[model samples]
Structure formats: C-alpha cells, structure tokens
Target chain A: MSEPIKTDVVIVGAGPIGLFAVFELGLLDMKCHLIDILDKIGGQCAELYPEKPIYDIPGIPFTSAQGLVDALLQQIKPFNPLYHLNEMVETVEKIGDPLFRVTTDQGKVFEAKIVVIAAGGGSFQPKRPPIPGIEAYEGKSVHYAVRKMESFRDKRVLVVGGGDSALDWTLNLAPIASHLTLLHRRSEFRAAPDSVNKMMALVGDGKIDLVVGQVTALSGGDGQISKAMVKTNDGSAFEIACDALLPFFGLTMKLGPVANWGFELKNNELIPVDSAAFETSIPGIFAIGDINWYPGKLKLILSGFHEAALMAQKAYRYVYPEKRLVFQYTTSSTSLQKKLGVAPERPAAPARAAT
Target chain B: MVQITFIDSRGTARTVEGEAGSTVMETAIKNGVPEIEAECGGACACSTCHVYIEEAWREKVGEPSPMEEDMLDFAYNVQPNSRLSCQIKVREDLDGLIVRTPDRQA
Candidate 1:
C-alpha cells in the first residue's frame, strides 16, 4: 500500500475564493493543501482581467482583480498552505468520516481529513470563433491575448472583439505595438464606457485603426500570422498586414469530472446543493461558486465567499466536535486608537450598544 | 476524420480519430481517454479539459477566446501551449496534432 498523506483540508482551485478559504482556514490555525489547474494562483481574478476594476467586493472602494488576489495572498501568507499548480483533480471520494481520496490525472493520490470542493465552475475552456483559416496560425503570430506586453513590443498587432478584454488589450498594446488595429463585427463596443472612451481617443489621434467588420480569413507566412481578410457589412472587403493577432472572445465553463460523480443536477446542468450548508446529495462533499444551485442563491463572488466560510465551519464541526471556538477581545475599545494604549475610561459598555 | 495523439502525464501516447467539427475533448472522451474531464460539456465554463499542444502545432491551434483565456487561468497545469480540448474543433489540418494532459484534473 502507498504511504498515506494527510492534511487538515484540501482546497481545489487557486482563484480569489479559494485563496479566501485559505485565509479563513489559516485564521483557525489549520493546515491546508491548495491546488489549481493553472501554473499560478488567483483563478479568474488573476487570469481574466487582472487590471479591470471590481467595485462590489466589500471593504475596498475599488480594486483591480490582481490587487484583490495579492491582498488575499498576503492574508494567508502566514499559514504556509501547500500548493499544487497545473494539476487537475479528477476524482474526489469520501472513504470514511472526514476522510477523502482525491485523485488527479497524473495518478497521484491525496488523502485528506476534509475536502473543500472549491473547483469553481470546473475547468475553464474558451470558445473560439468560426473564422476560416484562423487555426492556421496558432503559436507563431496568433494569440488569445498579449499575455505579456513585452513580447509585442514594436510588432504590428490585430485585436478582435468589442468586449472588455479585447478593448483593454488594444489600449494596452497601442503604445507598445508598432501599429495596432481593432476589428469588430459591430460598430458599437461592449466594453465599459471608460475603456470605449479611451479607444475612441486613441482612434482620434490615429494611434490605432478601428475597422468595423468581421474577419473572414487568416493567412500566415513563415509559420506566423501575415495578413487578415476582413469583410464589412456593406460588401466591402480588405486585407491588413499584421505580425500578430489576438482574439479576446470569452470562454465557457465545463463541469469537469464531478459531472460523473452522480450528484443530482437541476436542468441537467448545475449541481443541486443544500440551501444552508451548500452540500450536494453526497455526504461530506460540498459544491460552491458558480457550479452550485439552490432556490435563492445569487451567483456572485460575494455569495461564494459566504458559502465557503459556512462550509468550512460546518466541516470543522464535523472533524473536531470536541474543539470549542472562542473569541477573545483584549479590551472594550471599538476603535483602534482607544484599544492600543489606554483602557476605556468608562466600564465596558454592552457589546450590543457599541454596535 | 482527423487522427490526434494525446500523451497522458505518464507519457503514454494514445491516438484517437475525430470527426471534423467535433472537439478534441469529445474525441478523447468518446475513445475513453482518461486524461480529459470535460466538466462543462464543452461550454468553455470549466478548464477541466485543458491540454498542452505540442510546440510545433501551437501555431496551427489558434488563440483561445477571452472567455477561454479566463477559464484557462482556472485550469490545471497551464502552459503557453495550453488549450482546452473541448474548445478546439477538429479539422483536417489538425490531423497530426499532439496534446499532453496535465498531471492533475480539477
């Protein structure tokens, strides 16, 4: 038999929510193993639009996705959570009370006392456009985004899509690229008004070319993107020479291996979970984030935050029933200033009154 | 039909036949390839079907959509050549393509 590996918790997916779980679990002085499919952590916040501003998350007035990820990482830095990147979790089975057999595509197995299925919409896959010859130039000159801006320095680039991702990349690439072109099937952009306004300014100054048309064909030379054939709505066609092409179209989410785990699903898609604990029909297993479904659950980052905390608490109670949680306040001062150096001059007011 | 080869993390290579327009993920799963777990049924919502394209064939497989890129951030074992097999539609040009499965699947 293989040597048994054990931990307090195993968190799948390194996205913002997953990292948040690490933060919470750390606060409880628990050890955890964090895994992600990507080479790095941060999940959607790090991968999708790191620069895009997120306004809804509490506490911060406005923060970029990457910024939020950085802060959360800092919060959990002291816990020393173990991380396994570029690894996909294929199966999660409950072997006994609070014990799980987690297997991966690589055949490595991990046994943990508790499992948190924070896989988050499973593996994320992209949807490609049906443009003819688009696949002809994959690595040489065509890309999904200018992932690293330095690579596109002094090169002519073509960007497709009117959405936030496309527009954002275009604006970012405008200054570095030798020449930049933006193509969209429709004249109007789907990006935020601020981004659209920036693109308009760049177009007005001739820093970038905005072509209103759809890409019909892609031709490559020297194993890289060379020219693109675009057809306008008014029966006009043109070809633009380019060194690289980036398509910022969005991605779709797949259920991954969990789909076959035999959980009851609603609408033949989302996994049905308990309204309170977010547990699926399978005991000791829980689903959170966009992949879960219930009567009145709102699919948002904040809601996922709430779900993860509650799931952790319930899982903790199951694993260590003898442990009692205690909250200690050194003093009655509500604000930071009074708590630091001086005891409250008045007898501690009722805790409820302070609120 | 296009014949594509997939190398599991263990370096075992298996070839599968894919009909034109079917996704690489579909071809692998239909043939009982163990590496790809297309969790979202090819909707681009999940990154479970992630595969790394051979460097030589990277240019042949175009860039992923923004949605796919975003999803890829959530995938396991992502590489510069990483692409979601479900998002890649099989065609005659991709007949000799090779992809490698990550060491783990989410």
Candidate 2:
C-alpha cells in the first residue's frame, strides 16, 4: 500500500509458465513484472530437479529441467521482465475493475491492471519433520530458519538433517551453543565433503556430538522445548536434552496464501480456470500452468504454454480496452518480429519450449 | 505385466498390475493406490514416492544408488529397506512384490 510500483501486469510466479507469460504479454506491448518465492527463478526445475532430463516438450527431443528454464529466460529476454526473487506473495485484493493490488511477504507491492496467477504447485515451503508435538516448540525452542545467530548463545542446540543447511548451521552454531548435537538418519552426509570433514573434526575434539538417528518426539511446555526423544535405526530410543532444535528437511510445494486469495479452488488445491481464456471467475485475473485446473486439463509444460498464449489474448483487452486487438503469429507478423528483435524480412524463429 | 501390492501405513493393502518397463510409482499412480505422490513424476527429484520394500523382495530390488541414497536423506521415517518406488522398475522377476508406504511423505 506504500505507493505500489505501477505495472501493466504483475505475475505472481516466475516459474517456467510465469516466464512464458511475459513473452506472450510482451508481444502485445504490455510490460510485466514477475515474483517468485524461491531465491532463484525456474521454481521446481531449479530447486527440485535441475539435472533431470525432460522429454515431451513439443519439438524438443530432450532437455534437462534447467535447460528448459534457461531457454525460457533467453526467449523472454526481449520482454526484459523484471523478477522479484526471494519473495512470497502474501495478499491480493481487488482495488478497481480489472485492477488489483498485489503485495509480497518481503513488503514489495505492485498495482497492475492484470494479475496472472502462474504460481505452479503454489510455493515451495520448508518441510516440517513429522515429529509428534513439534508444533508446540516451534518459534520458541525449535526454529526452521536462523535469523540471527546471537539468539542461540549459551543454549543446547540439536541440528537435524544431512543436507547442506543442516551441516552449515551445525558448524556455525557449535562454538556458541553450550552443547551441540548433529543428528541424522544415516552416517553418509549429503553435505559437501569439506563440511563433513570439519564436522568430524569437531566430534573428534569433543566439541560436538554426532548422533545417527531421527527425532521421534519433543517434550516441552509453554513453547519452550526441554528434551527430544530420538530413535536410532536399531529401534533404540534416547533423549537429547536441548533448548533449541533446528531441523532442515529441505522443501515441499504447498498451496500457501494463494488459497486464501478470493477465487475458486478445485479440491482446495488448484485454481479453477475456464479453458477459453484460462481466466478464473475473477475478471482481469488469469491463471496458467500446473496451478490451474480445468476439465480434461493436463498438467504439462506444453499445456501451460498453450494456456499462456490464450490468456494473453484476453489480458490485452484488460490492459487496453480502447485499442482494437489484432492476432498475429510471431512466424509471419513484422510487428511481432520487431518485438522479438528479429529481422522483418526473414521470419523470426518460432519459440520452442526448449532449444 | 507384473503384480505389485502396496500396503499403506494403516495396513490396508491394494494390489495392481503394472507394465514390465514402467516404475512402481507409475503403477501405483495408474491404479490410484493413494500413497505415491510422485511429485517429480519419476524424476527421482523428490522423496514422495518413497516405499519400504518388504524383506522378501529386498535382494531382488537391490540397494539404492549413491545419488538415491543422498535423496533418501530428505525422506521421512527412512528404514533400512526404504527405496524410492520411482527407481524400482516393474519386471517379470519382481511379480507379486509387496511394499509398504510410510504414514507421510516428506
């Protein structure tokens, strides 16, 4: 609400689908700004499976998940869409007919004539370890993210998970914490070799305790944790007395705040959009990609691309109601070619899902 | 086709037929076994398709690759016999394979 950055279209996600939307909107002379929860773009492609090979992306025979995202970034370069990374969209409210006020958890706000919900699978959030009664201790003695290291001074800390985040924090907090313990389900670590060596040295020096186990339960009162019940692979249970517990269980996609935004949801998961314009019940708001649900809808990247193209056609009307809309293919239209920064005489190469 | 039985955490067992080349995760998804999320669609990027291979079929299923072992670190309640169903290929020798799904996927 603090003098929102005005834009023609504010896309709620910067995933592959959202990135593609920028291109379609740009072809129609509409500037767009995109936002994503992850620190980096590409959403699941970058976070979950960057190296995995992806097939069935139209003409492209094969490309890695990251490869497709790179291609998309290159294709949308002409549009030069601004991306607000490491931010989560928290609220969306309608201010005027076909106009919306969108705000992010990072306090950035945007006022746009068109709001596109291209958020696929909602947003990636920290995965909570399914330990019994862990909720009561959260934000008191248990923390997912460390905002400041000074808070852990002179406290018994238990760090869980074998990934980089777990190893990184364990090494950083060991010196400050009264007694630190690194608990993992297995001996082999997913962290870098150098960090593992440093961790082992700490154990050798008796600076930290490395327990090969999983947290089964938490015992605490008034949101202050006192002890944690851990179970080893051999089914033996032991108690780790700790004031603070940090469990790094990676991330999972959830329907997050978008579920609260005024709209219709199918099965409380996907936004329901009509197939023609891929617009939800709300006017001037459109949804594309896997986040959208329609009758006989296939959750494929290609399907999302098709949805983006059709949604742009309807979105142009909202951004420019007085101007007559003309449909032009990038393959043949000189104006579309100019927008693509290509030679008008030679036809602009059609945008493949991934080059 | 090979037959696979998926036993949920509640002990409800569902048996279904799977093609020889498809993955156990795919078979569960095709049959609507209700446990395999397969969030990454058999890319082995997520642990949602995690299942504990029964003791009887442990040897035939084999050990997880080092890459898979790294990914298992993200799964919940991982046991000695745990394996990502997406990595388990359905085959003639693995007919009547029984696997148990954990209470939740991480």
Q: Where is model 2 chain A poorest over a 10-residue stretch in terms of lDDT?
A: A343-352
**How many residue-pair clashes does candidate 2 contain?**
0
Instruction: Give the candidate number with the greatest lDDT.
Output: 2
Interface RMSD of 2: 1.0
DockQ of model 2, rounded to 2 decimals: 0.79
Q: For candidate 2, give the docking quality class from DockQ.
A: medium
For candidate 2, lDDT tens digit of each residue in A1-355?
4679999999988888999999999999999999999989998889999998888899999999899999999999999999899899999999998899999998999999999999999899888888988888888889998989999999999999999999999999999999999999999998999999999999999999999998989998999999999999999999999999999999999999998998868899999999999999889899999999999999899999999999999999999999999898899888899999994466769978875
The alpha-carbon deviation from the true structure for residue B64 of candidate 1, after best TM-score superposition, in angstroms, is 19
Q: In candidate 1, what are the lDDT values of residues A1-355, reduced to their tens digit? A: 3465678787778887778777665555557887777768887767655777888898788998899989888877766888988777888888887678888766767887777777776765444555666677776788864558999999989998877889999989899999999997656675898999999999999899999777788887666888899888676899989999887656645667777777877776688888688777876677777668899978678888888777766666766768986543435423422323344567876678545
